[model samples]
Target: MHPKKVQKLIYFVFCCLFTLPVLAQNRVVTGRVTDAKDNSPLIGVSVVAAGSATGTATDVSGNYRITVPASATSVVFTYIGYTRKQVTITGTTLNVTMDAAGTALNEVLVVGYGTVRKKDATGAVQKVNAADFVQGVTTNPLQQLQGKASGVTIATTSGDPNSSPTVRIRGTVSLSGNSDPLYVIDGVVGADIRSVSPNDIASFDVLKDASASAIYGSRAAGGVILVTTKTGKAGTPQITFDAYTAAESPLHLLDFADRTQYLQAYQQFYGKPMPAGTSTTSDQGANTNWFKLITHTGISHNESMGISGGNEKGHYRGSATITISKEMCAHLS
Candidate 1:
């Protein structure tokens, strides 16, 4: 070969020898971790290379960077409240979304004055969790529990916005006034359910029969309703907002006489047409609709915003909400 060609071939051979060693070494791995429900990043999640000591934790934004040997087959990602995830090392970057583990079977319920595990409680107590309750435009917390609990009956005496519903447990107790069950909120005995908003409640527990009511003695005669509010989870501070707007009208409107019918009725009763100019309003012309005049679409809204956070030791949550509704009157229009 020519001298220049020989030199060029020698240089190429040297470069290949140097790169071969690097290619056999460990590979760099990167990924991100997020929540499956909200897609929020999970920080400080443990990421470990399978069958190797190589490992790293995610940053505040759930991004992780690590290096693993060529022998590594997969990487494992884990968080406290989420299920573990394993991804094969097929590419340079992997993104994982983890779902919350099933923990409802281990949930704790607040009874009369104490608390007990849900599985251990033998009472007829039926629990309606935050997810099961009706969420929108509910002022009196009892409204959230309507028809959800067995043997519980909810009745509203009127459509007044400020009035709370009468929640009866196990029918009439003594044929007396307001046989509604007693409400206990956060351990406050005989609490008013109206004071708490459905949007703020975390759980609604109803204690029925003697087994469940034995905790409170005579006060439990009418049964009991226990309410628990939301609290922060162990993690970084997070802000959340939820809102709902609803409009409601009567299911059926009343059928009434129009102007012609009113005049006819007057003629039938008094043998005379409707007196001219007796009423200056449209009703005199029979064009006025009595039902429509008094009835309007009832509008209601529920809005809430909160911030919560904590570490392993303790956690707290604070929130504010607004609810608007008007009394539903008879729709004469």
Candidate 2:
């Protein structure tokens, strides 16, 4: 053969020798990954061949296929909020069940000046997520947090929707009857909770003991309520709309003396038939239903719109809310 032809033939033989072993050593492994607690398939799980970069991710159905080299003895599976697992390769098919990682204990709490894991925190703290908030037409955000946290009492002075609910932590802590907990919004001390719409709230971290005093001073004597509003998330821009309407009316009315009953009572007290034409400001001779005349069905509505989105570097969110409420008491025209 010619010198150039001989060189080309040798190069082709070397390429085959190097590629054949790699192709033969690689094997395809397939399996499904699921949650151990509920046995639900877990999507987006990362599956990597042990000791090699060869890896793949579980699809929407939680099924995965990876090319494992002969040098790899196992495969690693990892996902957020789940325990990492590794399985020895015994055959072409491998199934894995992943247990949930520490949920409550592993929660990252937003405390004063920093974050602390719930398991490490020594103070009496409770967290209420947005998903757990009360649903209804609410004029105040605190109303949404009612009955969600322990050691917290939330009540309104009346049934009027305009009135803000009073929040007390561990009952009345003051002689002045002002048991409002200190409001901390996004690291701003004494921020007004009303400024943030209920639909914009992300979560509430309530510090319900004397330990809170160390952070916000005596103002937190009743307790400390840390409010974290929703912010933009890393994803496509999202627009959300929330609205609710409530109708209010008195369930029962007090039974009072009507014209006939009042006349009979008067006659009984006087021990004779009352004189006729005894028309006075009190005796208008009209059996008017004062309860019906003074009250009517009231309506309350709340509507909110928000938009949020961002990338890994930063995010932004903005929202607006409109609320209209009317009391049951009818106005005499």
Candidate 3:
């Protein structure tokens, strides 16, 4: 054998040794997600192979690609507002359409110490989230859970921006101490609801009956409000920005009288003469809309920024938010 030929064959053998392992790990799965009802592409659907730790999420166009272990037998897909779907592995490409789980019986609910399926909970607990929150510009988290939760009453005695709403569970338990439900935000025993941003909340659960509230012991006589925040997962870095702008006019603007209407009403009843130089135009002078004068459009601007990322070792997430609101009422003093 020639030395030059032997060296060429050795180089070829080295290349084949390294390429075999790379080709063995080339098992890939690709798919698209869509809405079951409309056939619309669904983005951000989480896809994970059952027997493997590797996972991936769909893109904006509802396309997903993930690498699975050779021994994997199934894949599971999940989204926040959709039903979970698991399919047996038979081929390389698997497309899925998720149905809207409006009445989510299998949905998970947080209880005293842990979580349970919504249908499995034996206690009287009502859950509220962004989808079911009371529609309004609410500075307090309790406002979102108001009226939706039976036996739960909320009262805002003072219109203070920083003031927390007084929550009473099934009315007052006792005449003393002004019955207020125990506040538990992100597992903090006595956390204040005012400190938590409404947009950052993932779930607001009310434990109304004894079965659910018993976990808190005697302190839960008035019931309990369990608040859970969002969490991070192992995935690519995700950043979110949210801006809220609210324009509010008086709710009962027509219920009150305008400047001209007020003048006429006074002249009709008491027969009082009109004040001199009281101009009469809708936009100017005395004819101004009294409702608009005493109350302007309430405007508030909110901004929030959050970032999350993680790996197999651990996950992390953090966010910050700022809100500025202008009072609509004018000082009469």
Q: Residue pairs in steric clash, candidate 2?
A: none
lDDT per residue for candidate 1 within 284-308, as digits (tens), equals 3457666776777788877888899
Local accuracy of candidate 2 as per-residue lDDT tens digits, 1-333: 899999999999999999999898999999999999889999999999999999999998899999999999999999998888999999999999999888654667766557787778878888899899998667888988899998899988876655678889889998975678899998889998878888888899898887644677788888899999889999999999988888988999988888778878989988867647665456564588888889899988888999999998999999999888888996677
In candidate 3, stretches whose alpha carbon ends up further than 4 angstroms from where it belongs are 1-108, 116-120, 155-158, 253-293
TM-score of 2: 0.64
What are the per-residue Cα lDDT tens digits for candidate 3 across 1-333? 999999999999999999998788658889899999999999889999986788999999999999988777889999997888999878889989899987755778788878898878999888887688887677777788878888888888865567888788888788766478898988899787888877677878899888998989988888899998877878998999988888766677566666767888877887667655655556355455566677888788878899988999998888888878877787787
Which candidate gets the maximum lDDT versus the true structure? 2
Question: Which pairs of residues have clashing backbones in candidate 3?
Answer: none
**lDDT value for candidate 1?**
0.81
Model 2: residues with Cα > 4 Å off, grouped in runs:
1-105, 158-162, 266-286
Q: Which lDDT values do the candidates have, in the order given?
A: 0.81, 0.87, 0.83
- Cα misplacement distance, residue 306 of candidate 3 (Å): 1.1
In model 1, the runs with Cα more than 4 Å from the true position are 1-110, 113-122, 262-287, 326-333
